[model samples]
Target chain A: MTSVEHSPLTRKLSAFVALTKAELAVLDRLHKRRRIFRAGHDMVHQGQSAQTAFILYEGWVCSYKLQADGTRQIVDVQVPGDFLGLRSVLLRTSDHSFEPIVDIEAVEVRASDLLEAFAQTPRLATAILWAASRDEAMVVEHLVGIGRRDADVRMAHFLLELGARLALVGMGRAEGFDCPLTQYHLADTLGLSAVHVNRTLRQLRERGLVTFRDGHVRFHDHQGLVDLAEFDPAYLDQTGPLLT
Target chain B: MTSVEHSPLTRKLSAFVALTKAELAVLDRLHKRRRIFRAGHDMVHQGQSAQTAFILYEGWVCSYKLQADGTRQIVDVQVPGDFLGLRSVLLRTSDHSFEPIVDIEAVEVRASDLLEAFAQTPRLATAILWAASRDEAMVVEHLVGIGRRDADVRMAHFLLELGARLALVGMGRAEGFDCPLTQYHLADTLGLSAVHVNRTLRQLRERGLVTFRDGHVRFHDHQGLVDLAEFDPAYLDQTGPLLT
Candidate 1:
């Protein structure tokens, strides 16, 4: 927590917003009470009333919604610098569950503390709002992929988007970075069957566009994947006033 | 525009956050520069760089993301009181398009004006942010429905949600409400084939759960449909802090 410059959250927000020194210090101050939850256990459940969220510092987590039919849809995957259960802080109950992909580090954030931060630094508040809007846009993009894009395009877009997001936080680059999502995870995310996900991954590998295998995503032809996925990172990196 | 007491935006946000008279006045003041938009035309197209949003005063509009393959996914169907393109004002370029379902009345909003309003009334700003969070939750719910729920449940949940949303605006009720969407729109929203949407509607009607026909949604067995859809509206109506 000492190296504010090394903070992925700071780096991500700073991409679009220039934070003042005091704002960076205030952001640094929010890193108290770091906690770790073991992988394979949900830290939050749907309908669980709460007013706390987490700022991920390491590892990966996913938010998912479970259905009455015993099936679950992975809504979003969280990485370092991402906020987990942020919407829950504003709403009475958490509408989804979060399961860590690995034993990870995070800082618990109270709603009051966040509001106090907003009061102290309006610019920081706007930057955080921009971050939230960016997260919402990513979900919207995912919804579009699920509703309209074919499996190939969907997989390609998902991977490329993740890569771009990670790059902003210094966790990944075009050649790719480590990944932990299994085929089942891909199935739940892409709205495809596990078999379908498996086939799609094989197809992408055959096409030499991207590869998601054994805890990594290696981009063979990043440009080719981008073209096929129609990937546009403008929403993620827009220089709109709030975004700035 | 004088009916501050009857403004649907006010009504919807007031359900979650009580607005003082001053907040209401500020909200009312945002309604200048009223304009009319025709149906069957896009006021906002995907990737358009802009800084203006609109507050819908009347009629329905749908936002959609088009794919390279000529197919489009209807992301959200907005009604009176909804802020169309609000997200676009934050992100430099809109990632989707907006098409009015009918001739509509709306007020234009610029980014700077909105920021000024937020600065004037922080509580009101929180309320509006609550509204945005509610919208994001709806999309997440739709993502879950499309990824995990069966066709019948998806359709039932979607219709019930729309009904609940419209009810807040005093435009709908428990028994039924007028709708302008076609089977094709349902297909896009639910990520199903149009034939599948048709079959599901027929099935629900035959089962006496609900009926969506000829531009209307009638709740034949409202409770039964809710049971079928497993609709828990906590996310939409949470009593959390920002909500208050």
Candidate 2:
């Protein structure tokens, strides 16, 4: 583990503090700086005690669950400035697993520290709970997508959503954002076959709606993709100076 | 329209206020009491502008989403004092519809009323938002149920969950609750055919696990249902008296 002097860790904590300054400062002070992980590493395991919650400083992480048969469902993907393990934090039990998808760095705060901070700052409690609520809502929207929408629409909707979220955190460029995700990951998230994900991605690229290579994606026609996906960001309810 | 002068209404409001006093009071003041509807009336429609949220004062309601092809998924059933339209309130649009299963009395608060109240009380705001968050999270759990668990397990899980929620608001008795529902309704909720629901209900009955007929259900062996469903109430997170 290194000190919080590093750029990635500093920037991420500052972003969370921007959302709830005084409270997150309490969290930031309690956090112990942790070493960066390589592209593939498990931060938490399913059914195990969730000891800490992470604020993703740099790179991506995924929250997922696995079946007895070894099949996995990627419940969510966490990017920079996103809060991980908030659901488990409230539940007092871990329901999913977390894995870093790229070279990763984060500040890990103990559950006790989080509970102490929540006890002191009601606003932070509200913010974290709201964050968890929004996370669950995203899962609801995804359920609707997979249960009802056609495959093409589902894939397009996912890409559009990823682009929007990444753009909000300044990780995205003018055209698109780095995907930094594989077809296998997309398959697990969307509940599709890996081959189907690959084909869909190819279709998206061939239509000139998006471009992706080497883990980076560039939207050639962002509005077109939005239309194709029938995407509307309204449910996100982006509010206040905090999320901004 | 009339005042909430009836005992049932008062009792239902009490449960809500018990969990969220001043906030529910603000909400209670907003409603102009309305007549209970017959079994078939639609409370809200999918893809429609949702004007208000409702709390069941007596009887039951069902929340459901309809497909483009007209297939319906009855996601959750609302018992006495249960919350509905909160999802629509949060999203600013209704993506599903609801209807009374019987003649049902309810208190309705306009979304404006809720927003105004939130503006005044941060604690109330947190409570309502947390309530909505729980609703949204239940929908996610439903997704997991259908996507992963088998039919019998799903049915058992659904019953266990409903019973718990009903118990929370005092609709359920110590041992079991009056079922207050039909096989068809359970079928729709579980994404199964009515015949399948009937068969599963029979299975639970014959195994000395449950008893149901004539709008009443008793858990003959409550632990059996728990084991059958792999039921876990951790997801409910029904803690904290601040917001009930």
Candidate 3:
């Protein structure tokens, strides 16, 4: 395939469309190439309309909401092959913000264009619907993590889940992964203090459950970490494509 | 209409069917009317197949899950004209339990049946997709309530949202409503102690915001309560028929 066909936006959609053989031509036509943003650039604002959906090709981004008191809640991390701005498409409004954590290259697809394609292809529509459900389930799991689970369990589950998702998209290695997420972002996500997050990471590394350094994580005993987190992957059953 | 035509289950389905005529016939055939235990009976267990989706026709129900230590978290409250078991419908497995809060009459639709209807009707499929999305937004709001809002604000938002949803299906009065939920259930839902819930209710009544007695609640100053809770009705949009 030509480099144009192998672009990150196309790569992301193709990964999905390859499973279902659903219509991608419309999306391909609507695709317009956009440049990379430097680290610390804002991709989406909390209260503004994020009219574009993005597929992260390189680098990382954080979805978060800021409070009036200068506090922030980091909601989710967008990685390669992951599309952010999906939840906003349904609401026709944006309720969160996205900021690039590193120099980022991503593909942006207009919501209207995607909806138009969905209107034409039932299979594509089904796939998109399933993706949205999977996204919501992730949020629910996060709620369960923060509301009920202890801090250690929450962090372990987050790492395990992230590794699994990234591996599925061929972004992570089998036993370890590249996650350029800072302890500050992780703390915001788990509703803990940054100091607490740093301490937890140190403990994990000391105990050999996982080791984090140089923007990479090594899962020394994946099953042990899962057992500690009580992590079950059943909540994420985006299996419709596989089933068909 | 004849009495059979006006059956509670039939009436509820018809109201939902009014919005999706094509999908209604498909759903009607798959729907089975069954009477299980009366008020306070568990409809579905956690970690089960989640084979059936219930549409409440009379009385109320709730969805909840428990931690390993036996602490319960009430996820959602279901009343007449509402579709219970929606989360499990997509997940294909019940991660939560469903129980009727009062003497309940409902129709159970199998998941395979709903999926068939979704495959056949475009509008219905779109509505269901939107229904799931709307449920997600509610979950997000709940997270905010649990993590950020005060006790009184959380309770007020819950009551007003429930009132608006129930009123849509002709189950509530102009200024009040009958929900049949217990203080314990309310406490679990709000993540507050029972004593705290009681005190908050007393405060609400004393402030002329709301009045509750005998499972019925009356809003003294609905707008005032809305203002206090910062309740936005956009989260409860009824653009769809049954699930919304």
Candidate 4:
């Protein structure tokens, strides 16, 4: 396997702990075996015993549960640098299905190998645990979005969150991010109908707060959006010192 | 500090990993300093620098975020053995407020002391991580409830979930559990109006599916309720081997 000079895992881990060269080498080796999946591919299915955890090297993946009424609720959106199945590694089964919204490049790390790595490298383990906690924080934030916020505020909050997460990996600018998700995905995520999502998007565009076109979202007034959504980035835990 | 015979923290940790007598002794010692909080008291407030984590030894607590519009979203319902502020310990601030739902007995473990414990006992650390992951899983499940399910299904699902969780700690019976939350809390949790929640509860009661009286819920048909909610316990991760 050809080694990449820099990986998103390295960038993400560095945010939690200053990885030594040796630590980086171990991460690089773990992520060397990359696999690509096309859009709409179910990378992991619910109830399946998950044996491997994937590191999203590129593109978007979403974890969602399909309800009895046939509607889906996306639990988490995975971007580059996100570990897809860290919790599954401990839980042993996938509680939700993971699928790619776009063509995705991911590196598969066997559960045994990851556990071994965690045992051998405490710093790396701390980073992984930090990542897991951050994921829980994000889920809680999203719960607030769906449970308390209205459609307009939910859309604003969702876009601002996506932009912030993307900016962490140097993918998006302060004002915008590449958003490949359609109105259907937004509907599922925000607990609104697709029609409602479309109307809300139009309202946001008319207000000059946000604009989505050509698979990208541009925030005309980032602060305006933030204010409308009551968005706070502190929950993301990005500004903290390295745990180690 | 008074030493107790057994603690919910020990029971919860033992589910994740087999605790040696020494580890159990440490946990018992950590939980010796019990604190009491009255109903409606905030255990940990949002935006506050959380210096400690609490183990819910008795009664109920909830972590919630208050919206700008004066509404609230209950992010998680904490039961006995639930670890609050584990994430806050890493993030340096509480992302959500934790409040007691009833007069509560809790063990306050300082964040620094918990970290020291983790450093000394990797097994204990792993158990905490498992607990965090379980919390995330519950949040994700609640997301699905609010995002996709109707009010009736949501209520059923919530009740069934509460029952299962309570049963884990030997609190609830097979058919029902003690439900101290009012319709207002249920409305907040399910993203419905209080009136709607009350009406739905009436409907469920009239249908002979469930009955709530004197702060206790009795399910006439557990399987019937589960079917309506499409509730699956696999997401709870109860069957997994302890992570020793």
Candidate 5:
């Protein structure tokens, strides 16, 4: 419960809304009960009653649904500072399961405690709603990419998006980031096969647009990738007022 | 502003939380401006500043994103009782556009007025949050379907979900529902070509588990179709308590 002014969650929330010192202290205190999970660990399972919300302090996690045919669809990827299970606080049970993509550390916050904080500070509630709305917008954009875009465009868009999101928290440069995802993870997220993902990555490499190697992706030509993918960051809604 | 107790919006809110008589009156007054649009009309366009929210009183509308290449991705289909632009009120501009699939009647509620209502009634605010959470959950499920399921299972799951949602507002039965979407709409929503959608429909008809023709769908064997699709309604969160 020490000073969390420089924490990733603080940085994320400050981007949207300015919080009072007391408010930050409250949030820091609320985000307690630190836990760690190894890669491939199910942080939460589908059909499970949602009792806790987690804030990723480090590493990556994915929320996905497993089909009857044993295939997985990664609905979303969580980076540092992203709040997991915010929506689950309002629902009875989780609709999708969550798994750690790599070794991870997270703080478990009680849903009731978070709701109480919302009641105490309406601005925090609005910020949470804004975050949720942006999440929905990103999901919609991902749907468009998966539904219409070719593998090349999809991979480019995905890489550019990851770079931008990581940059928001000062984690990556404009053209590159430390990507921990494998071809299988990309396949699950982009609705492509592992082979297709590999081929798409090769095509991008051949075109001199991007490179994915050693768990990192570096864009040689960011604008070219953006143009090829028709990637627009407006859907992220990062420029909106924090409190409205 | 007269008695809206039995209105679709009222029913929708009631399903989540109990509303007092005074709250109902306030909601009725807020939902004052009524408007109508024909099929294929865009109710809200991308990049538009969302100043108002709309409640679909009748007919169907879809929120979609139209790519530069002219392909459309229907992100969500709205039936009666669904609130539009709840998220838009928080964001600067809409990321996706909305269009009506059939002639639609909607009641316009000012975003400022809705905010006022939320400030006055904390329970109403929680209910709205709950509704928004459910919307996000549905979008995530749709993502899973598009990303993982094949054409047949996807179609079956889509139809059953529509039937269940329509049944919520007393618009359809367990075994049948009036469907206004064309094969083109189905194709756009499911990420398939129009020809593929047609072929899939034919396959389902040939299987004798479901019949969709002339804007109507009858499930001859509801359980059979459900089993085939592995459709589960828990993601819809329809059975949760109306109020926390």
Candidate 6:
């Protein structure tokens, strides 16, 4: 494997690990069983016995749990390099569902394959665990947003964090990023009503912080939003491979 | 190591792993460096560089993040079997603070020791990872409760989940358990005010479902509370070690 084989997973992991050539070869093999899933449909459902995990390479997906009242709470959105259903694969069941927001390209990773890979490559396993920790950190941050922060700050923080994550994989920037999510998605993700999401976005736009329209999230005042949300990237920042 | 040497951690991990005597010996090594932390003080603070983690052997602690407005959200409560600061230690920093609700007994585990332990005992590593997944699952459930469920259901679900976790370590039961948390802690945890928590408890008690008074939670109608909260223990249930 060479530089030509560099991928979002490789790139993200590289931020933490100085991967060897052999490591790259193993990672490339893991990416072999690629598949495409359609938009607006579930790729995995809550409570299903999970046999295979996924490494998302392209497009967006939202992991959510449906309630008896017909409402859903989007736990986290998956972009390129995110491993869908990986956490619960070892646990034997999926606690939530993953719905592709658009056509998605992902590699299916069986449990045995993943375990074998972990056995063969300790550094790569560490990097993967590091990524999982980041995912959990994002969820913790989301918990803080919903439990403590106000609606406007929560919305701002959510957009800013999304941009930061997308930036990791070269899909976004601090200024703005193209987003396929609608206000309804925002409402579900932020624990706000559809009307409240609309008003919150309007308020943010008026304050020159950010705008969520035209299928894009435009950050008019990136620093302002960060200040308003008290957004910190320290948790998401992995300086180098600590495993060494 | 044998059944006589079993501790809370051994008990919790045993649910997911048939740990060998050799593995149990290594797990016991991790139980060294035990310390006692006083109540009403933080053992780990947010944003601090974390070098070591702890295995809670006894007592309770709350992990929380403070907002700029002098408000804090209790992310999760740690019981006897909980692993405090374990998640963020490898990541290099603590994102939340752990304050003991009562005097706590814990065993300090350094990063090097934990990594070495993992290398020496892969099965125990897998079991530890399984426990971490269970912790993340609880956080996800908490997210759902805050994002979707009403105040009453959220409190009921929160208490029931706490009972379930404590029961795993032989500290709680279906009827009730002693709790050290105050109304302020409940307010922070449930994303409600003290007034709201008081009212919610009163309502539950009036309906003969539960009571939170005199530092104890008495479940008068356990089944009724479970039904009201739509509580599911499947996520927390691990029949046996999947690693083997």
Using DockQ as the measure, which candidate wins?
5
The best candidate by lDDT is 6
Q: What's the C-alpha lDDT at position B52 in model 6?
A: 76
Interface RMSD of 2: 4.7
TM-score of 2: 0.73
Docking class of 4: medium
Interface DockQ of candidate 5: 0.59
Collision pairs in model 4: none
Model 5 chain B scores worst on lDDT over the 10 consecutive residues at B235-244
Clashing pairs in 2: none
Candidate 4 is scored at a TM of: 0.92
* Candidate 1 pairs with clashing backbones: none
Q: Write the per-residue lDDT of candidate 3 for residues A197-216, one digit (tens) a residue.
A: 99988998888899878888
Model 3 Cα shift for residue A122 (angstroms): 2.8
Residues A3-48, model 5: lDDT tens digits: 6677777777777677887778777787767888999979889888
Give the CA lDDT, 0 to 100, for residue B202 in model 6.
100
User: Considering only N, C-alpha and C atoms within 3 Å, which residue pairs clash in candidate 5?
Assistant: A16-A242, B16-B242, B17-B242
lDDT value, residue B74 of candidate 6: 88
Query: What is candidate 2's CA lDDT for residue B219?
Result: 83
Please list the residue runs of candidate 5 whose C-alpha ends up more than 4 Å from where it truly belongs after superposition: A20-26, A240-244, B20-26, B240-244
Across residues A1-244, which tens digit of lDDT does each residue of candidate 6 receive? 2331568888788777788888888888888788999999899889888867898998999999999999999999999988998766667788889999999998888877766666666666666766777787889899999988899989988998899888888899878999999889999999999999999999999988888888999998899999998988888865656654
Reference-based TM-score of each model: 0.94, 0.73, 0.82, 0.92, 0.93, 0.94
Chain A of candidate 1 scores what in TM-score? 0.96
Q: Rank candidates, lDDT, best first.
A: 6, 1, 5, 4, 3, 2
Candidate 1 per-residue lDDT, tens place, A1-244, comes to 7756678788778875777888888798777769999999999999998788899999999999988888888988998988898788777788889999899898898877776776666666656666777888989988988877889999999998898888888899769999988888888888999999999999999999888888999999999999999888887864323444
In the order shown, the chain A TM-scores of the predictions are 0.96, 0.85, 0.88, 0.95, 0.95, 0.96
Of candidates 4 and 3, the better by DockQ: 4
Question: Weakest 10 consecutive residues, lDDT, candidate 3 chain A?
Answer: A13-22
